[model samples]
Target: MLGPVRIAITFAMSLMTTLASAQEVGSQKTFPARDSLAALDDPSPDAADCLRGFAWQNAAFDVQLESDDATLRSVRFPSPLDTGNPINDRVTMKWYVAKDKDGNVLHRPAVLVAHESGSGMTVGRLVAKTLSLYGVHAFLIHLPHYGDRRDRSIKPENQDVVTTMRQAVVDVRRGRDAIAVLPDVDTSYIGLQGTSLGGFVAALAGSLDGGFDKVYITLAGGDFHSLLVNGTNEAAKMRQKLADAGYSGDKLKQLVQQVEPLRIAHRLTPEQTWMFTGSEDKVVPFANAMALAKAAKISAEHHVIVPANHYSAILYFPTIIDLIVRESLPADVIPAALKSDS
Candidate 1:
């Protein structure tokens, strides 16, 4: 019933709307905080109690703890990246504790949250604090050379990304075991979530530990080598440039394959995963996400926030907090409708 000109205008508007929506969803990673955990000179005493079962790996940090009915504490342990390199020094951890609605300590499950070195501790703290609000205990971990070892050195300018990734997985396993023994915490409900490099770490860790209850990953890819080979980010491109200049492809490929999420997918439960990604992410492409998803052998629900970019995607902290708090609640008590939505 509309004239040709009017119809044409309407179609144009629709196209523009769709394009705008896609653009928004493609670029959202806004979590902002640098060296959050590093900002603290001393770990909280309560946090130390949370690490009761953990064994000290070094004076800089410790691991292995059994959860108790009392107050929670913060604790740390050595990460695989602690190669004594001052440029990339860091201590991984299991910190934070979940509580009940009555303010009494609840034996809720614990989770380990990881972030890229560049992102610093802000992302990890945000996740931990938010999870605490949701009655879930979480450890804000230091990746490679961020917290605890911010002054550590960097050995390989072009580090073995895959080996580095596997090391992270190893640390996560140790952290998980240390936390699982806690008294008030539910070991069966253990889970993980991360941002950027940490997100990739979470996916890989989930693949490595089938006992992991659930996963909420953001800005991560399933395939390690694919991300390195086809990535458009400054880091990835830089790695490629280094390779073009002199690095060996065989070594790169070997390392990447060892940590590639695609290769580890068989270890995860498809029903317990959630992946969030930006369509406009320059560091991690949508294709890599898709590839990882396909390789996961699970149909994960993808939360698309239209018009969000990489840096801003994590900025929606309140939303993430809500999801974690709600999802981390006692699984049996969750309403069917809310469960379906999550």
Candidate 2:
């Protein structure tokens, strides 16, 4: 079943006019992306223990295209964070295929994107669209209870917070192997990008076993436990949700710890991981961002900071996309600008 667009984003890589919409050619070809989790092999007990919390088996899982089009393909896979519910057990990813001027799908780099906590995945979709414009196949994954996977019948108070978070991290990691088998992807380079809520999940997922070639975390940080206890806006809301569900004190700490970033962020290669943050951001805060940078061992060059707040960070969207394409992707894919964009 085709999932409707969760949010209609009306912006560009740099806050310019919106680009053309994806050509949704109803279901075309349904194929599978073979699991490439074997490459992430690590025998260390430390790595195993850390990833076991979220990655579950830390083994390969099925990734297949349930539906597709000329540009966008709907991917479905079994979530490693399975909770026995058929609806929430499956993972759905929006694959934005990149093509050349002749419209031939390019076998270029691919990036998996995780969205913020808002019901509408605004920034996540925009980032995926922007990255696709630059020749990288981008996949926007819907976390549990976000889009089609959401069980509208269940009330918010009844949802399981810890399990949802655990499943999210595992799903993101599985995305790396999922993209690895797509024909439109180069396979050699698969990365991840997450903003805010997604960023926190990506942080843990990217560290699971170095499955991704590159990882970018924007507007998120470590000590998610603290973020819940003291964060404002989305954090406060999520905290309240947990509180409503009778999760606090030791229970709350345990919930966040299951998917915390700092615990295993050190596993990611410093050169391949990047962190972007806002200087005056109060939602996630500068201190939180810095703490993640320190734990992840992100170099100064990799930890980019802009003088903006959480919401205003949208103003620098163009700059962020440009830098990601330049640094994370191969050099040859870089162009002065897309001919279509110009």
lDDT of each: 0.57, 0.75
Native-referenced Cα lDDT, model 2: 0.75
What stretches of model 1 exceed 4 Å from their correct place? 1-72, 77-91, 100-104, 149-160, 237-245, 248-251, 300-307, 331-342
Candidate maximizing TM-score: 2
Q: What's the CA error at residue 44 for candidate 2, in Å?
A: 9.8
Q: How close is candidate 2 to the true structure, as a TM-score?
A: 0.86
**Model 1, TM vs. native:** 0.67
Q: Write the per-residue lDDT of candidate 2 for residues 198-302, one digit (tens) a residue.
A: 988888888876788888898989887787887888788888988887889998897777667777777879999988899988889788899889988999989
Q: Kindly list the per-residue Cα lDDT of model 1 for residues 110-166, writing each as its tens digit.
A: 777886656345666656755654557787666654555455344444455544555
Q: RMSD to native for every prediction? A: 14.2, 5.6
- Residue runs of model 2 more than 4 Å from their true location after superposition: 1-25, 28-49, 58-62, 66-68, 338-342
Q: Each model's TM-score?
A: 0.67, 0.86
Q: Report how far off residue 129 is in candidate 1 (Å).
A: 0.8
